[model samples]
Target: MSMTITEKILAAHVDADEVRPGEIIDCRVDFVFANDITAPLAIQEFQKMDIPQVFDPDRVAFVFDHYVPSKDIASAQQCKITRDFVRAHDLPHFYDIGRSGIAHVLLAEEGFVGPGDVFVGADSHTCNQGALGAFATGVGSSDLAAAMALGRLWLRVPETVKYVLRGKLQPWVTGKDLILAIIGRIGVDGARYGAMEFAGEALAHLSMDERFSITNMAVEAGAKNGIMEPDDVTLAWFRPRARRSSAMYRSDPDANYADVRDIDASALETVVSVPSSPGNVVPVREVAGVKVDQCFIGTCTNGRIEDLRMAATVLAGRKVHAETRLLVIPATPRIYRQALEEGLIQIFLDAGGAISTSTCGPCIGGHMGVLAEGEVCVSTSSRNFIGRMGHRQSQVYLSNAGVAAASAVLGRLAHPDEVVRAPVPV
Candidate 1:
């Protein structure tokens, strides 16, 4: 049987001679990542180890991003510990809050990940980088401790689930809609411990931002990873900014797929994942009449420059609906500065969208834009788990930036194509 890119990569990483779908292989991780929120605890555990230094300093990346600028005392303490520990260890890839966006974004953008690599992170969304053909997944504090102590970890090779998307995505329908629709069909945990492989002509047309949106939510499907074969689009995205060497991955044509899903892109519409679960999805029109109190258009999941550009296109010359409170948050200082230089920030401001600092913010209920009881918000951020953003009573609808911006203007569910023709340049 032929293997998918994900399976091929895992095969090379497996300790055994080869790994097949449904088979478990004991393999060691190639890299481990820790950030401000989780690194503190992992570091505390590492101190208990007898080893004087990390097994491979170059293989570890320490990043401070979740609560960059320290929203509260607890977060401030976490950031301090992260900074001190990384500096003391003389790690090669330590990123401060400003330089740090989300760890996965930074890791992929920095060319730290490659095909057949086994990567782990303390954050659940660490699965985001699996798009690059690595066996990337999240782990708990105890698992992170072991990885740090030995620079190694065990893994069970996962089966690959193939999603072959054909046709073109409608103007308003983006990667967020595709992922949500898939989750709705398969249920939240349908892909548990499995690998998702996206292919077909539709993927060839997608940009890096779009790929990230899909891969970021793989964890919601309970998948070990989500991956796509690297093509010209992937190469173009990394070629210019690649600091060091870059690597790519391609799937074997004859590879076996544990499961296969076929999506006709032309058939897709702007879909939304309702509150409390990512798989609670429905078409926008099904819930269009409902009014919303807030709209958010940023997060690691969809807060890149491309997302802001899409929002700006939808909001140009339009005002946010008086009943809705719209907020835009850049994911990093680089993105914030780029938005300013491109005047995308002005468009948002003119549209009555409040701008917040680059942080996880309302996405994780960390800070900013907390929803009140019974309030409803449409957001571009990932996840809609119960109490994810604030009070359990609050409702959150997840969509792409286009839908988020359009909803802000209508104060109800709105599709981006109905409001704008195309994405604005940044």
Candidate 2:
């Protein structure tokens, strides 16, 4: 039986010959994780199971990325519960405030995820690891507890939707723009309960960081998961960091797909998702001149070093608009250190942008750059739903880091070229 990469990984985990879409199968999980916002509840559930300890201490991780440094008493208590549980279990994978980054980015950086693996987390962006050709997805807190206790999860196989990318990307256009374009064309529920499989020669042009950005937002499209086949680029990024052996899987040529879409990458331009919905996307030029009170560049979606570099390139030799405030966040401690070494941190400070310790703060309306009522923000984070970043009436426009930086300088939604005379490389 021919199978797509998603099917292949799922089948291998279950010791099955092959698995079909919509079929329920019990499979072993390679890794399981939960963040501060979700882990506390998951821990409560895990305790109810009366399980002495996790299935495997090495395979379970707890990350304190959201509200790290504790936004308030309630959040502080939540972390305390999870901290107590971790200490009791003697889990070596716990990442506290100083060492924590976004769970999705930190897990990959710490070498917990790899190709042909099946992993789950309590957060929606868990699908982010599917970029490495892994079968990854988000689950509820209860489901996370079950996985942590049993080290196995039952999954209803998702049908695959293949996307072929042809041609080259335009300058300043990135994986973020491509995903926004996809979500705009297919609405939010377009791929509900399905797998989005990305392939085609254009994958060669995207860096591992960009690929992570694309997969990170697959949940926004309502997909069960998003994946890319392992190639030289994927191997190059994972081989050095891999702590365990990894198997690379590919879709059989004759594999069945629920749908196929071919994207012309060269035609794509820098685009942004307008207020309230990621599906509401438009070219940056269309929304140009709209006033912005804040501009944020960080999150699992676009907080990599590559993203920081892009923002810094646009902000160099210029000052942020006095009417607008800029916040720059690196996704992980390592990335933060790299940015400092590269002098990107200085460029942002010189441009009047505030830098933050690695945290998912403003991205979740937790702390740090929360929006005021009726204010406007241009962010590089995933999702912009109502009240997602702060006041329900506040608006968020989602864009790549370069666009966010350019918007910060103009005090409105603007193209990066407006700030830089030449096209900044992707």
Best of the candidates, TM-score: 2
Candidate 1: tens digits of C-alpha lDDT, residues 117-195: 7788998888777666566888877678788778777667788888999998987788878888888889989899988
Q: Each model's TM-score, in the order given?
A: 0.93, 0.98
Query: Which sections of candidate 2 miss by over 4 Å?
Result: 422-426
Worst-scoring 10-residue span by lDDT in model 1: 240-249
Q: Which candidate should be chosen as best, given lDDT against the real structure? A: 2
Predicted candidate 2 versus true structure: per-residue lDDT over 1-426, tens digit per residue: 999999999999989899999999898999999999999999999999999999999999999999988989999999999999999889999999999999999999888999999989999999999999898999999999999999999899999999898887899999999989999998899999999999887778999999999899999999999999999999989999998899999999999999999999889989999989999999999999999999999999999999999999899878899999999999999999999999999999999999999899998888999999999999999899999999999999999999999999989899999989855334
For all predictions, the C-alpha RMSD in Å is 2.8, 2.0
Q: How close is candidate 1 to the true structure, as a TM-score?
A: 0.93
Which stretches of model 1 miss by more than 4 angstroms?
A: 243-247, 421-426
lDDT of 2 at 7: 96
Tell me the deviation in Å of residue 153 in model 2: 0.9
Pairs clashing within candidate 2: none
